[model samples]
Target: MLYGNRSTMSALSRMTEGNRLAQCFLFYGDKGLGKKTLAKWFAQRLLCSGTGEKPCGVCKNCRTVQKNVHPDVIWVPHSGKLQGFSVETVRDICSQAIVAPNSGDKKLYIFADCDRMDTRAQNILLKIIEEPPAFTYFIFTAGSRQTLLPTVISRLVPFAVSACTEDETLTALRELGWPDADAQEAVAAFHGNIGCCISFLEDDNVKLLVSLTKEVVRCIIDKREYDLLKVFFSVSNDRNSALWLLHDLEMVFRDAVTFRLGQDIPSISCDPVGAGMLAGKLSTAKGQYFHKCIGKAHDAIAANVNLQLVMSALCAELMSGK
Candidate 1:
């Protein structure tokens, strides 16, 4: 019972009625908006010998297709680090599309991350896409259709997968065993990307944040010196998203500090342990001091200050015996 976009499901249902289940479709959307999920589901439907709309999810062909072992269904990832389909890959795909299906009515090829494709590879794709085999279905996914060539664009039916509404996103999270408060925070933190929310939930860094934030707050309350540079360097993964992770960490810490000092903790961190740990370390003056340092640290980090220096200053400011 995987979730699906309601709008997309309706449009697809209409397409099934219109008999425009063309040989090719271009699915466009932001990352983690379930383009690949829907593509795979559609592939299963096409491969199924079932009587109705959905693949029976029980037939031999459907099971194999769901497990990604179907001979007639090919899933191609962007070949390069920057995320684009390769010319060689496109040629390979075309070669496969022409072959008859081993056990189904159609041979389905899904190209993920088509936005990374260069002009040459796209041109290669455009040729076969212009006159695809009657039994072949080519589904390409891109971040946006603007990245695709007009020639390629005109050959396929475009399917736009939009981000789910906040309520829909929250409901999905709640179904994943998250409490209402935690689900709300995860929705905001991941901007409604279920995969990213799951990533955050499973992150080792979050586990560390639970303990480390408590220890840092204890130091602040008891007036002991702590080193920020070591913590900062340990947390940042040498990527652009590192900053985002840091911001999220700081929010959790602030919530914990408030909870520790008998203040209402903002229900913004998904980790319950983190909230409880901070709650155990309450002191009025200490909480205020720590909150001020958090603001300063965020400002320094945002200004692109040297990471080590920012960490050092932040640690010194928050630690009591410094």
Candidate 2:
């Protein structure tokens, strides 16, 4: 069910076939790019007891791993309260890693969202990863390996999972029973991040955010700065929601730029009329300027700037560009 990353998958498939699979691998890239999925697939293949090309998909070991009941497979859980893997949890994993597998010859340990792990936790895990038992296999998934210690990164092979192509994303969405129009919209909004696309499709708040973004755009075009400020204030109390709205607004501007270019690209907004109106209002230069302002707002939010002040300034700047 994994889409894209053909070359990386091919290389991994070859490694497994040749029995040259490394003891540890670091899968890093954009979120929802299927790094964790690929790690699990590789682990299933490694543990499959079938005689044919590994996994076979029907073997008992593969089935158990698929159902997440495999005794030999260890999935390191993240602590939501800490927002990362705690040092205590990493220590427990190290203790578990030293033990022999219960059912298979090799034990596969998968750590997801590893970029959230602090240095202390990573260092503790690094010691085991450095001199892991012959029966142990480790896979770590992260948005970027740069967050990890250089010493830890040097001990493992790295695989970069890129986002899927537009066609691939559309196909996957359709396969999941999404309507053609809805799938196309999600693809445009998420830019082929399947995880984000799925989240957007399932969340009603995302629909509201898109609507709010369209309203903000309309306000900007009509020179309704006060109305725009009102809308911005409505979401100011919820930083996460406000940030998401800003992100959607950024995408709307991007779509306007695409529209001005006369390209037949998919649009983030479902309303063709509004898209046309916004596109007609923005010249290439203005579109670029607005996009830059939106990017600045995102940076300011990440820096923990005051929400009201940031939103007020952003609305003022956006209106000035009009």
Candidate 3:
């Protein structure tokens, strides 16, 4: 039952003590901030049949849910390929929500990545949230509240989750048995996102991220045209990782910009020496150009435009001038 940031744990514990069961709760935060994990924890508590403090993980209901074999708990995953929740998915959840729990006291429906729910799907969801079944409870997670329908957000109690502090992040990484140095670097790479830090520790993807960042800085300063597609392929082989890589690239460039603007060099996200070197090479005007290019890249990403075109434009700007 224990997961996520201390603040969120405190809030949930306080609410549990008050015995207030909210029909819906809006959990919003940056990626890797444990919103999904916290949602699962909340759902477990609601489904627990224990006598006290609810999520007695020992309870039969809690055990079934923990093993993901509970008939009463319905989990709807947002389809990453489609890039949004489908109407059918929403309808399915609605149908399941009305049914009484087969074993637990409440029927728990978890909508992961609710931000991916399109307008139509969101509207359908709003109707359900407005009048949830008496014994139903809902847990939804999103990257931002703006991605949700306004009506859906208005009816839900909101919880803002964020990355844990530096110490807590390190502790979480160590709990995963990550090496001290690797843990430190992962924390820096993820900007303290606990989930990302854990992933970086367990995966080979972080190596590509570090390599890509170094290449990007090299290409930026060389002011030479390079195979942008090759770089993209080398770093991001999938849509999900592509999004993370794009965001990480933006942050790397932002650190360079910060260093160029005469900020603390150690404050940069990448290797300090590399950051300072990149900063030293970037003139003020070029720094501004890079920053502008990053903004455009972000817009292209959000619009679901061609990633190649966005990368090409960014490369053109990045290689423009000394």
Best by lDDT: 2
lDDT of 1 by residue, 216-235 (tens): 44454455564444555665
Clashes in model 1: which pairs?
83-116, 84-116, 84-117, 223-320, 223-321, 259-279, 260-279, 260-282
All-Cα superposition RMSD per candidate: 9.3, 4.3, 3.4
Q: Over all chains combined, what TM-score does candidate 2 have?
A: 0.75
Q: Write the per-residue lDDT of candidate 3 for residues 1-322, one digit (tens) a residue.
A: 3444667676775665445556788889877788877876777776677888767888777777777778877777666555577888888888878888787567878777776677888888877888898788787788888878778889887888876677777887777678889888886766567777776667787657666766766666565465555676553335555666666666676777788787763342544445667778777677666767776676566557776666666666666654
Q: What is the lDDT of residue 93 in candidate 2?
A: 89
Give the least accurate 10-residue stretch of model 3, judged by summed lDDT.
265-274
Q: Which ranges of candidate 1 are over 4 A from the true structure?
A: 1-4, 16-21, 204-322
Cα lDDT of model 2 by residue, 57-175, tens digit: 88999888888889988888888533588889889989999999998788989998786688898889878888899889899998788968998999988999888878889999999
Top-TM-score candidate index:
3
Mark the regions of model 2 whose C-alpha exceeds 4 Å error after superposition. Answer: 19-21, 80-82, 213-322
Residue 227 in model 3: shift from native, Å?
5.9
Ranking by lDDT: 2, 3, 1
TM-score per prediction, in order, is 0.63, 0.75, 0.83
